[model samples]
Target: MPNWLLPENIADVLPSEARKIEDLRRLILDNFRLHGYELVMPPMLEYLESLLAGAGQDTEGMTFKLVDQLSGRTLGVRADMTTQVARIDAHLLNRASLTRLCYAGSVLRTLPQGLHATREPFQIGAEIYGHAGLEADAEIQHLALTSLALAGITQVRLDLCHVGILRAIIAEDATAQKDEMALVKLLEAKDTPGLQVMSADYAPITREALLALPNLYGDITVLDRARQVLPALPAIASALDQLQALAEAAGPECVTIDLADLRGYHYESGAIFGAYVPGLPNALVRGGRYDHVGEAFGRSRPATGFSMDLRELARLMPGAQRKLAIRAPWSTEAGLKEKLQECIVALRKAGEIVIQNLPGHENDQDEFNCDRAVVLENGHWVIKNLD
Candidate 1:
């Protein structure tokens, strides 16, 4: 293999791992369906103008741009599913006043240093468009919780923040946006001194908020501290109230708020949230509201969506254990192979994994790796239990 031929961050998923990932995605999509969110497979490639219309800064840098041969127009591979859903909401489903859309597909983008460095990631997510209140936010949070529950994750931690709060504060100080972006990265890294450096030149109110950012973690009480520091903004206050209600709805055990969390695209204008399993360094799921994206696309609809990185969630799953092969030792005769295939189909229908016996390659070691064995001996069906 030539050294420069391979892409920098793409990795192949082998059969065993791919099977588990498919199963995981199925579980998540089923839960989405159960909640009345219909599945949608937006086109993997869309016109470059349409695709980039609503995507914020975080996604812009990652999009893989190209030109279409047939149409002779600029085109791009979707870097994320959220913007495509927004396009559908604004145009394809333009007649529908309210929509709930779900999707599962691979998004191509440059991976950050710590994100397992996989540029191609499988994303499963939902979007709720045309609603613009706390109820919408609550519903999004509920979807996140129930999806995790269906995945057999009993201990999920939520880190919630309001982009409105950060944006509101930053608007007062022009320097704050540049500073806060750097400060957010430092805070996410848990570096207090770095945060101080970022906020050093800001006014007292802004600097104090940045200094206090690290301590804005913990339970609902942290909201009280937020109120004390930046009390006047109604948008921030209403967002805080919304979080309180959402926490009550999510229950104390499954959710918690970390005001310091600043993940997601930069255009978020309302609440932003992330989901984490205990040991993972990054969030498995992320989302927020970006009302401006609609206007950016020449549509007036406000939208909010969340997407779970199926790759990261697949890793954190407790039962990511690989399934052993199931082998059959039936004779290679036409009649016997047909009967064996019938049995294998039945087992598969019952949600069991089965491996067909390879002709002319059967050995004792191959037979032992299977869950069970069925063999034809003396015209009788002989069953052997490997386990």
Candidate 2:
């Protein structure tokens, strides 16, 4: 067996990549602050039950669980920050007014969401509690898009889906309610024959409505098609209206509707959406409205937000060049030492990285390209380009 080998899909992030992630993290948090979202840092672990409360139930398989040494109760490593933020809002903040929160941290998932995904995702997101209006959802969506744009991902296509539409249909049918998972798989797989067979004993309109879902995809006009083909249940109508209003708010050209795309239906209580670009294999950003995710915490307020894998985002962004390096000679001359110290302070204050040439090591040992050097030209210290 080899030492230093990481488990499958888990690898080290070296300095360059780490710096990019750090820069993007600061930019995102700065953006969040500008929008009135207060920063919150939840611990990486918690009791399993409270950790998986409400909307977090969907993350069960992906979470890593262990026995707590002190409490003896099982503890789980969070795979998502939304549920934790919900706890902070409902149980900790206990505020009646609207609350906006943002977080950035590493979460250990049991496995990647897809073939090329990472088991450890740097989850960065924001949450808004108390405002249930389309306005709050729009604000979150806009903030997410704005963050991606700040990271240089401008060619974005935003797809909108409402879990409420599908939830409404399922709640209307007793048999469907009894076997929701089976039907969800069928729909997700686009198994028309399976959906038809499963929906056979259902009411005629409801059966037809269930079948129409998988085909409800495309531009904003898909909403018009959905309204016409799906059963005119009041809940479905209201859900569609909300989806339309959000799309309009997001700009018609920037939005698309996918009624059958029930990706987060079970976990997401209301609207769910994903941000895409042409070359990326998965969404760069994901968010939605989960109105009662705080229910388990006892406050149960309306909430919405978005998160992005910061590594994925940093990969898509332009790489940053290593900053200036001012190499100083290793000398003990009292005057030379004092001058070198002064030079190091001045250069660093000017935002340049100063690398002192260490004893018995080449200046190149610092690994940064020796872009500049501190030289004593005619007994006074000065900086000159190495090249």
Candidate 3:
């Protein structure tokens, strides 16, 4: 293999794509700040236990683990940033009131999430801690939608799900609770036959509820159907009510429900959601409430957040145009050089992109589009339009 070859599903981002990604990152983070979210930069790697504090098997499987040389403890490359931010809130800050935190960084996964997905993703997101009410969930959902809009992804479909629904159903039957993981997989796949065979020994009501889940997906009206078809367990009712409130808050036009979609079933404590747009088979963003995550860090607080791969989201956006620049010639004459440098500095200070053309690279074509040039006309630097 060639020395320049990169690992599979990992490749370098060249100038154009990198520019788009960086610009989008700044835009989203700035919006987050405006919404009162403080930025936090967590390390890319940490002790395995701390990294997977309240995460489930999925996160564990995704995390890349290695033994630490100094502490001799196992360390993990973070596959997700939510848990790290949660730990910060629980131990580092320990604030009592509502705390909003946002982060943007690279995360490594042991395996690629999809056929064309990257093993290393530029993850960007925001989290709200200490607020357990449905209002916080609504705020997060709205924030996510607004962020997508800022990225020019306007035709979005917000599919909402609640982990509590399945938890409530499984709580009614010991057999189903024992086979929770298997049942969750079946539900996610919408495998009615598999669920039927596995849930045969479950209580009749549990089996019926489990079977009913696969069909309980569609617009907000699905909630009404779920209320009618599923058993009226108090927990189930509460989960449905919360889902309804959040869906209404998100607006009925683009909101939908999926009772069987249990993507974050193990990690999320309450409502979960995913935002999808055209041209992408997978969701562009995923988030929900994980109130129990902080408990593992010794400070349990209500928390909810959402994250998206900035690289992937950037691909969906229109390519960034080459920035207009002021091209200046390099000069070595004492007086002329100083004056030319001053002019270039002044232009740059005024937010203009200034590119100094090297002696030999007079006709070099590069990233910046230089439509204007700084020339030493009659002993003074002046700007002139390039022919």
Candidate 4:
């Protein structure tokens, strides 16, 4: 086969890996449902204009663009599920008040030519549209905690920050522009000195806040420290209050509030955050409010949501050795398929790994390389050990 025929950065999900991912997806969705986020499966493909309506230039760069032959117009694969949900809220939902939505699906994006990136990612997320208050932010934060717990992730540290503070400061003062991006990079790298150089232009108070960010990652006490150092900027103050409330709601042991987690997508308008697990370099989940994005689609409504990088979470999941396999023999041909299916179903019910095979193939033994086998003997079920 020609090399050019290969799809770039995309991958095939094999049965084992796919099953693991599907199980993880179910866990997240179940937790989300318990939190009152009704699932909404958005289209895999949408009109390019509609999908790009609320997405920024950075997001646009990742989209897989193409023309729809049937309609003679351009279309694109969704790079992110949040934007698609925002589109749904604007045109399809059409509700007067808040609507809560959750979704799980595969999203496609283009990777840089040489850099390694997953072009196809599985995302599970929730969106809340129309509410405008810190409570909404707090509620979402709490839900994020619940999601982590449901996924069997107990050692999770939530880094909470407010985009409004950084955006407000940047919009009012251009002097800190370069420094802010630098600070973002510093945090991304976990580099402290780089942050110091970048934040040198800011006021002593602002500079301290920026510098304190990388090390400010911890429990509820971090919020108290931030309150003492930073001035009472309303947006920042409100975000802190909400964070404290969420910490309280999630209990002292399960959640933490970091005042310096200021990195997020350009569309964010309020609180932003991500969930980190032990041993994972990247966040498993990311979310924030982007009220302004709705305005681009003529909705002019406030919106907030989050998405989990299933790939990242999957990477963190404790490596599971494949389940012990069971092989069924279908030699008699007396309703063999049905009998084999029954055995398969029974094994599944008993939580055992199972496979079914034909007569001679039993000796060939490729299906699951089964740990054990069940053969039909004479007129009765006989067992054979594949050890």
Candidate 5:
């Protein structure tokens, strides 16, 4: 095997792609700051129990675990940043008032999420804590859409779902509650026959509701259909109402509903959403309310947030153009040397990229496009257009 060969689904990002990713990261982080979201940086690895505190089985499966040589405790490489941010809100910051936090960092997953996905994803997201109302969920949803819009992905489909719907359906039914994980799997796959077989021993209403869920997906009208088809339990009704409100808030044109989607069913408490863009088949961003996550840190707070892989998002954008730069010749001539150094410093200070070419590298081609040149013309250093 070649020594330079990277692991499967893991590859180095060269100059152009790295530039795009960095630009998008700055743009999105700036937008988050403008929205009053304070940035937080959590360690890439932490004690396994702490890392997986409120994260569900799915995150556990994705996380990479190892034993720490110093502390001798099991440590985990974060597969997601949401739980870490939640822990910060619950323990470290411990603010009594509403707190908004955002983070951007690389996470290592045990496996790639998709065939072509990278195991090392640069994740960026924002979370709102201390508010349990639908308003917090709405704010997070809008911020996610805005972030994508800032990235030039204007045409987006925001697919919304509520974990509460399924929670409500199985609340009283012991059979359905016991088979929750299996039911979620079936629902996510939209496996009607599978769901039918799984729910055979469930209560008639529970069985019917479980079967009805697979078909309850589409535009906002799906909510109306959901109201009629699903039971009239308060929790179910409340979930539908919240979904409707968020759908209306996001505007009907760009919104869709998928009661059976259940992407974050295990950890998400309510109003889960996935933002889909034109080129990507899967969601470009995923977020929702996870009000119970903070409890794992011994302080329960209402929280909602969304995250997207900056690496993946950058891939969808056009390649960044080579930045224009000024090429300067390296000089050691007694009088010209001092003046030339001053000229380079001044140009750089004024926000110009000045690349000093060594004598032997006069024909070198590099990342920056040197469209201009610094020359000692007529005994004074000045800028001139490169021929």
Candidate 6:
């Protein structure tokens, strides 16, 4: 293998894609700022126990762990920034009122989350803490939607689900409680036979309702079907109501309800949703309410937020988001030399990209368009397009 060989599911960001990703990151963080979300950059590494404290087993498996030379303590690279931000809000800031926070950084994953997913994802997201109202949930949903739009993904189909209903049902049913893992897998795979076998001992209504979950995905009518056929458990009823409210308020042209949706089952305690576009095989954005994730930090707070892979997004929108480049010569003529330096600085300050064509480096212009250049015309430095 060559020395440049990268680990599986990891790769470098070449110049063209790097520019797009950087531009999108700026746009998103600015949007977050406009909403009063404070920015925080947690370290790339932390004590494993503290990193995994509130994130649960699933996140623990995704994190990359190593022994620290400084203290002999186990440290883990963050697989997601959400847990770290939650820790900051609860244990560090300890704010009593609603606190909105945002972060953008690279997270190392031990395994890819799905097809075409890289091991290292540029994770960008926002979180709202210290609030538990449906209004807060609604606000998070809108924020996630707006985030997608800002990424040039305006038309998105939204899927709304509530893990609370499934959790509540599991707590009340003995058979589900006994074989929760099997049922969850079956639900995820939408395997009807497997679900029927697992829920065989459940009461007829409970068994039927459990089996109905996989098919309970579509438009608002799915909620109607759930209300009609599924057991009228109060928790189930409430979850359905919240789904309806979110769908109506979100106003996504295509909205769906899946009561069995539990992507982050361990951490999320309420509504969970995903955003999708036409070409992407996966959701462009995913978020929902996670009311108790900060518990390990010794402060339990209500939280809701969403995150997406900016790398994938950049791939989707390939056009470079850069200003026009103007190439300048490294001239040494007495009258033009000092003025060229000043011209380059002024152009850069005005938010323009001015590339200096250094000696014997013709290939430098290959990566950028040298459409315009600075040259000496009539004993003065002037800007002119290349012939």
Per-model TM-score, in order, reads 0.83, 0.96, 0.98, 0.79, 0.98, 0.95
Model 5 lDDT per residue over 84-110, tens place: 898899899999999999999999988
In model 1, state the lDDT of residue 136.
79
Q: Candidate 2 clashing pairs?
A: none
The candidate with the higher lDDT, 2 or 5, is 5
Instruction: For model 6, state the Cα shift of residue 230 in Å.
Output: 1.3
* TM-score head-to-head 4 vs 6, winner: 6
Q: Candidate 4: which stretches are off by over 4 Å?
A: 1-9, 112-117, 170-218, 252-260, 321-326, 332-354, 363-378, 381-387
Minimal lDDT window, size 10, model 3: 359-368
Show where candidate 2 strays beyond 4 Å. 363-368
Which lDDT values do the candidates have, in the order given? 0.75, 0.87, 0.91, 0.72, 0.91, 0.85
What is the TM-score (0 to 1) of candidate 5? 0.98
Worst-scoring 10-residue span by lDDT in model 6 = 361-370
Which TM-score value belongs to model 2?
0.96
Residue 332's C-alpha lDDT in candidate 5?
91
The 10-residue segment of model 1 with minimum total lDDT is 362-371
Those runs of model 6 whose alpha carbons end farther than 4 Å from true positions after fitting are: none
What residue pairs are clashing in model 4? none
Give the clash count for each candidate.
Answer: 0, 0, 0, 0, 0, 0
lDDT of 1 by residue, 1-387 (tens): 887465877777765567668888898898888888888888888887777775644577788888899999988888888877776677677744777889999988855435455788888998888888877778888898788777677788887887776666666888887666676677666688887777778888877777776788898788888888773777778878877877777786667677777775366777878887776777777877777766665676667778887776666665455455567654567787777778778878987667666667754542224767776768655556776
Candidate 3: give the clashing pairs. none
Global lDDT of model 6: 0.85
